[model samples]
Target chain A: MIHKRITKRKIIDKLVFFLSSLSVIIAMIPLAGVLIFVASKGLSAINLEFLISLPKPPDEIGGGIGNAIQGTLILIGLASMIGIPIGVLAGIYLAEYGDNRFGSLVRFMADVLSGVPSIIMGLFVYVAVVLTTRSFSALSGGIALGIIMIPIITRTTEESVKLVPNSIREASMALGIRRWKTILFIVLSTAKSGIITGIMLSIARIAGETAPLLFTAFGSDVWATGLNKPISALPLIIYRYAISPYANWQAQAWGAAFILVSFVLLLNIGVRYISRERYKK
Target chain B: MPHSFFLFRKIKLKKIKRILSGDFIFKNITLIFALFVLSLAILVFYELYSRSQLSINKFGLGFLFGREWDPVQGIFGALPFIYGTVTSSIIALMIAVPISLGIAIYLSELAPGYLRSPLSFMVELLAAVPSVVYGLWGLFVMVPWIRDYLQPFLESILGFLPFFQGPKFGIGMLAGGIILAIMIIPTISAVSREVMLAVPNAQREAAFAIGATRWEMIRVSVFKYAKTGIIGAILLGLGRALGETMAVIMVIGNRPNISLSLFEPAYTMSGVIASEYVEATQELYLSALIEIGLLLFIITLLMNIFARLLVWRMMKIFRGAKE
Candidate 1:
């Protein structure tokens, strides 16, 4: 009876392990399926015309989202300007002077900010900025995106700053250099690749975000000329076109999705390459 | 002698100011940025509450429990959305936990070193895919697949139950749950894997020495030690599922209903806010939507704070173990 029980226990353990392995396979289906399906459907729609012209009417066979691409770049630039300075500076504070209770509070707030859904941030911006401005604009969207970017960039900056060895600081201090100068010139330069990687990741995240842009930027079909005007974006075009019934619009949505995914993926890999080369040393 | 002494004192004052200025300026600037993050949180809550006060005053405490949600007649209640968000997140939790645990185990214990990082990156990629893309996929591929096959299969297996009695509408609570599961699996699995990795090697070796099987070692020793971290990961995942908007809105059929049937169409708190906030014409309707945003903000804030506490404690434990 004892022998039988032990053997049975072993068998049960084996079964559980097999089940765990099976679940991993099941988890991969959506991950791989979404990418593959989007690629296959979106590839045929991509051409030069798809890259450099205005969106066509629903029935038109082919049109491009050139304006949306330019708008996306401009919006990204606007978001970077708002997010990076405060985020990096706050990160420096965390790394350098954040051993106190105030540091922990900021850390907690950063996590909370990350958890706030992207759409709600848009609504927050709508209440705070859009209402005052009396209209949707690229400025509102960028502000919303900038808020989302802050905690992410801040955390990454903190981690990378922390990773720089304490010996560097000690060495600088021994040379009679001031603390702030050492941090700003030596430590930050040493961690530049990592910091840039963090920024790149932040950009990639906001680039694909659609919910925050829905009401804030309030998509336009034409090129957005000024900061106060509504801007077209790649994700918005994909969303609007995908929801439409027209075949051409749907095709363009696919094409745009392809481009968007490709852009984010290439950016991730390229940034990783730059960072990893430094990490290897 | 008096004039020379006064000039010397002025020179000393200027030199002190110059010496302290650079370092002091940098610290204060960064400190201001850090303070801004704290104020940002307070400002969000303040704005949400201040903006939603009109609805709060009109509805009193009844806004939460009231069922009617009519824009035409200026009636608003958040009950359906609350019910929908909680139930869908529960469904997602049920579906995601097992799969996430599995992936975590595979990463931490089963996978060979050669295949580990690549597989981990692939799982994280699921997170990187935009939520809208997931919505599109759910609408075009997953929903139809469910309507034609998965729903029918579930109905046949459990049709006697009330929860399974509804017709397959393709996009509803179950679909929302599935999409949420897909989105949240990465956060849970990634964190859980880190937790598992932080499990000490001595525990594993000791279990082996006692003649425990591989699974037995993982279950009785490794996982037991890392329980808090795993729970933290699940809570973080729950927090995410609750706040998810776009995919839920796209595939949840946008109906306001409280039903036991997962196949029935429903609306979520965030979903309703996302779908209707822009089109709201009445001031009351707009305020009501802001109230929902406030509730979402409060709920997510509480959950995240609790989750972060658990994670923070787990990190302490790991640090102690390492030392």
Candidate 2:
């Protein structure tokens, strides 16, 4: 009886392992499918003209997302200006002095903020900035994306800063450095790569966000004149084109998607590389 | 001697001034930024609440239960959107939870060490794929596959069920659910893996000491130990599915109706807001969309808080065990 039970148990173990492996495979199918479809469809549409020229009308055969790419770059620049300082400072406060009720509350709120849908952030910016300005602009879109970036950056920054050894701070203070100087110069520098990794990951995240830019950027077809004017973005164009009935527009959507995905994936890989370098040290 | 004493007193005062300008200023600057982070959530809530007051006053609590969504008549109700969001999310959770748990188990326990990082990286890459990209793929690839193969297959096996009885339009609750399941698997599995890893090795060793098989050891020890955390992870995934917008909008057929069939078209709260917020000409229409946004915001906030608390508590328990 005991021998029979052992054999049965072993068989069950093998079956369970097989199922677990199958689940991993199942999870991978969609990823592979999305990547394969985007790559194949997008690669054909991509060229120098596609990258540098303005979009053509839907009935027109070929066009580029040059304006959208430029707008996306400008928005990223604007978002980073707003997000990085606030996120890093808040993270510093949490890591250095946030051992109390208030710190816990901030941390919890940051996590909650991160979980809030990107669309809602768009609405908030609509009410706060876009409505106030009376125009849809790249600035409003940048602010929306910046809000989305903050909590992500804060959490990652806090985690990375916490990874810095306490002994470094002690040594800095031992050398007669001021407390603020010790943290700003010594601790932050020590955690620099990790923090950059976090920043890059957050940048990658905002790069792919579409929902927030829908109304705020409002998506112009022409080149954006200024931060105050309407702007186009890669993901926004992809969304607008994908939903339109025109086959050509849909094709352009795939092309834009290819660029967006490649940018995000590259940023993620760069983050991994930075962190790996940190680990090696 | 008096001159030297005065000079020493001046030096001390300057030192005090330097401290005030440096550490004190630096700490306060960071504290202000932290305060901003904390207040952002409250500000979001306030904004949503204040912006949606027109609908709140007009529809009151009945907005949640009423079904009509006529933009011309301006008789907006949130029930269908709420239903679609809840149902799609439930379906996603149903599909995602098992696969996620399995992936978590494999990654945390079963996979060979050499294979683990690459597999994890692939899963992370799945997440890194943007929502729009997912929508594009869902519309072009997955929706066609559903129309051609999966929905018909489901109908053949489970045609008697209400969910399986309808015509397969390919862009409906089922597609939304499946797409959402794919999107959330990485989140659920990653968290579940962390929770499982937090389970002490001693539990597994104890299970094996009783002559249990590897699967038996895991089932008895790790699952039981990490049960709350895994549930928390599933809830987090549910929260994500509930608020997902662009992907769901692309393939969920974007219709406003309450139906039991998974093959019928539906609209989610986020989806409606995304599609209508731009075109809402009427004040009440805009307010109604904002109200839906408010509801989505509040529901997701509550779900996240509850889930995070559970995960936090579970992690705390393991830390206590270690100590």
Candidate 3:
């Protein structure tokens, strides 16, 4: 009877193991399906004309997203300008002198800010920037994206800066370096790779954000006139085209998605590579 | 020689003064930036509250319970949205929780060491796929498949149930729920896997020492130990499902209606805001959309804080145990 019980337990264990493995397989189907479908459909839609020319009217075929591409670049540049300095400095404060209640409050708030939905960020910017400025501009969209990047960059920066060995700071201080100097010259350099990785990841994240850009950027079909004008972005274009009734627009949507996904994925992989290299040292 | 020594001392003193000023300036500047980060959440809340004032005054507390949402008539209510958000999120959790748990278990317990890192990376990649991309896929691919096959199959098998009784429009609560499930699986499994890994090896060893099978050991030790954290992970996933906008908007048919059947069209808080905010021409209409956003913001904020606390507490317990 004991022998039979042992066999029964063994069979149960095997069954549970099989079920768990099967769950992983089931979970993977969507990921694989999405990647494959985007690539296959998107590759055919992309070409020289698709890259260089402007989008055709909705009823027409053979238009490109060149203006959208330029808009995306402009918006990302503006966002980086706004997000990087503020995020890095805040992160520095948290890492170097943030052992008190106020510091913890800031950290917690950053977490809360990160958890706020991207769409809400759009709304907040709309109220603050768009309503006041009285137009949907690339500036407003960049601000929205910039705010979303702040918390992610802050958290990652703090974590990576914390990972820098205290001994390095001590060594700098021993040389009569100012505390700020030690942090700026020694600690930050030591954590440079991780901090860069964080920034890249945040960029990847905001690059594909669609909701926040909906009202803020407002999206234009023509070439962007100025930072003060409505600008097209890859995500906004994809969302617009995907929902429209035209088959050609839907096809263009896939192409934009392919480019966006490729850029984000490559950045993520680059982050992984950089972090691995850091660990190797 | 004395004059040269005095000059050198004077230069050293000036350099010290500069360093002190630099440190002071740097510290305060960074502090200002840090304060900006701290005040962001409060600012968002303030902005949302102040902007939604029109609706707040107009609807009062009854807004959440009122079901009508006609913009032309200026009769706004949030009940259908709240209903859709809750029901769709509940459906997502129901389907996602088990599969996520299984994946977490496999990753933490059963997977060979060589296979673990790559598998984990692949799961993370699932999350890295953009929301819009997912929406595009759901629109073109998943929705059609659902309309033709999955909904029909479910209706055939479970047609007696209220949820399965309606016509299969494919773009409804069920489709939204399934899409949400796929999106949140990565989050739940990743967190649960971390929590399970934090369960001390001693618990497992003790279970094995009693001649318990591997599955039994996992059930008695790992699951029992990491239960709170797993719940927290599930809540985190729920929080994500609640606020998901684009994909659900694409597939949920964007109709503001309340129904028991999952096959009928529905609208979520985020979905309504995304679909209608730009088009809202009237002051009250705009304010109503902002109010929905406010509700979504508060719910997600509370959910995230609570879930983070649970996960943090659980990790702390494990860390203390290790010490």
DockQ metric for all predictions: 0.71, 0.82, 0.70
- Of 1 and 2, the candidate ahead on TM-score is 2
Model 1 whole-model lDDT (C-alpha atoms): 0.88
Q: Candidate 3 docking category?
A: medium
Candidate 1 residue-wise lDDT, A1-281, digit = tens = 99998999889887877877777888889978888988998898889988999887886677799888988898899899999998999999998888899999998899878887887788889899998889999999999899988988888888889889999999999999988999999989988888888899988889999888987998887877899999999888888887788888887888888888888887777776887697789
CA lDDT of every candidate = 0.88, 0.92, 0.92
lDDT (tens digit, per residue) of candidate 1 on B137-208: 888889999899989999999988887779698899999999999999999999899989988898899999
TM-score of chain A of 1: 0.95
- What TM-score results for chain B in every one of the models? 0.94, 0.94, 0.92
The DockQ assigned to candidate 2 is 0.82
Residue-by-residue lDDT tens digits, candidate 2, B1-323? 99999999999999899767789999999999999999998898899898899999999999999899999998989999999999999999899999999999999999999998889889899889999999999999999999999999999999889988787889999999999999999999999999999999999999999988889999999999999999899988988999988899999999999999999999999999999987897889988999999999999999999989889899999999988
Q: lDDT tens string, model 2, A92-182?
A: 9999999899999999889878888899999889878887798999999999999999998999889989999999999999999999999
Write down the DockQ of candidate 3.
Answer: 0.70
Model 2 per-residue lDDT at B34: 100
Highest DockQ among the candidates is held by which one? 2
Q: Any runs in candidate 3 off by more than 4 Å, and if so which?
A: B1-20
TM-score of chain A of 3: 0.97
Alpha-carbon RMSD to native, per candidate: 2.4, 2.6, 3.9
- The residue-level lDDT of candidate 3 at A21 comes to 93
Candidate 3 per-residue lDDT, tens place, A76-147, comes to 888989998999999999988788999988987887677778998998999899999999999999999999
Which candidate leads the pack in TM-score?
Answer: 2
User: Once superposed on the true structure, which residue ranges of model 2 sit more than 4 Å away at CA?
Assistant: B1-19
